[model samples]
Target: MTLLEVSDLRAGYGDLQILNGIDLSVNDGEYVTIIGPNGAGKSTLMDSIFGLTDHKGGTVSYDGEDITGLDTEECIRRGMNYVPQDDSIFPTLSVMENLKMGAYTESELSDEKLQDIYSRFPILEERTAQVAETMSGGQRQMLAIGRALISEPDLLILDEPSSGLAPHLVDELFDKIDEINADGTAILIVEQNAEEILNRADRGYLLTEGKMQREEGAEAMLADEEIRQEFLAG
Candidate 1:
């Protein structure tokens, strides 16, 4: 089942077009990554789907319904959650408080659900009362992810999740993401860590200059000589 679909998507900030007829999709429980260099409009594509950009043209379908220009709140009601690269957590809030906010839309906040998130990131459990801003960068990222997971979203959209983490922490972050996908949540990520993310994703798309340049199985993209040299090579 196709969980999310974007067709001929053209979006950007007001009066400045960034994405040009982009097409992408994430099926139920699939792990999909978009890799591109800086200024390729990868992040714009994500914002467009999440309804944070100016929608010039295109159809964004979620769960078989058209959500082309739906607001972020409505998108969340439809079981889609987005964690932007910056300011993803409330700096002044405690770890538990941030997570509780994630479940604000729920009719009944389930303890079991909270437990699952804590289990996924034990550090969050340990620092439930710790102020979000006081934690290390990696721990803050974990808190952000744990908060997003509280709602049990069908699709979790992440932008550059490993951006500022230490090299060792990058692997740990990816491992947690893998665990999330394994537990049946679909992921749509735009990552700068090309080799790292593409190596783990089930499928990947190469976006360049606001357009999709290639789509292939994750391992295949890594193996392609052209892709390796042009995008993955040192």
Candidate 2:
């Protein structure tokens, strides 16, 4: 079943439009990745679906409900969680505090939920009391992802989750993400590192100038010479 769907989405920051009629979907327990360069509006499409941008047109449906133009809180209420590219964590907060904050909306945040996140990212459990900003870049990303998982969302949307990490750390992060998806949470991620992410994703979409240029199976896209030379070669 389709857990989330965005049809003919058109949105941007303000008067300036960034995404132009983008359509995307993530099925239950599926791992989907969107690839594009810096200015391809990949992030814009994410923001639009998560209700962070101006919705000029289109519909965003999640879990059989029409959530078009819904706010972030409503989006979360509908079983969707988002981790943005930057400033996802509170710099001054301790690791534990940051994780607790993720479930601020929950009336009864359980220890089991927290433990589940820690178990998924062991480094987060190891650095439980460390201040978020004091951790290394890779650790910080782990904390960010851990915080998002505290909500136990059905769909986790990640924007450039591996932007600043070293190549080795990026591989480690992707491994953790694979574990997350294997545990039954659907993933919709956007990244510039096309080949790396595509290798792990179930399906891949190539977006350019805010429009989807191609949608193909992850392995098939990686094997296509033209796609590799035109997009992944960068």
TM-score of each: 0.97, 0.97
Candidate 2 — which residues are off by over 4 angstroms?
Answer: none
For 1-234, candidate 2 gives per-residue lDDT tens digits of: 999988999999879999889889999999999987779998888888888999899889999899998888888888999999976899999999998888887986588998788788888889999999999888999989998888889999999999889888998999999999999999999987889899899999989998999899999999989888888883
Candidate lDDT (C-alpha), each: 0.91, 0.90
Off by over 4 Å in 1: none
Candidate 1, pairs of clashing residues: none
Error of 1 at 176 (Å): 0.5
User: Mind giving the per-residue lDDT tens digits that candidate 1 earns over 1-234?
Assistant: 999999999999999999999889999999999987889998888889989999999899999999998998899999899988966899999988898988888775588988888889999989999999999889998988888887788999999998888898989999999999999999999887889898889999999999999989999999998888888864
CA RMSD of each candidate after superposition = 1.0, 1.1
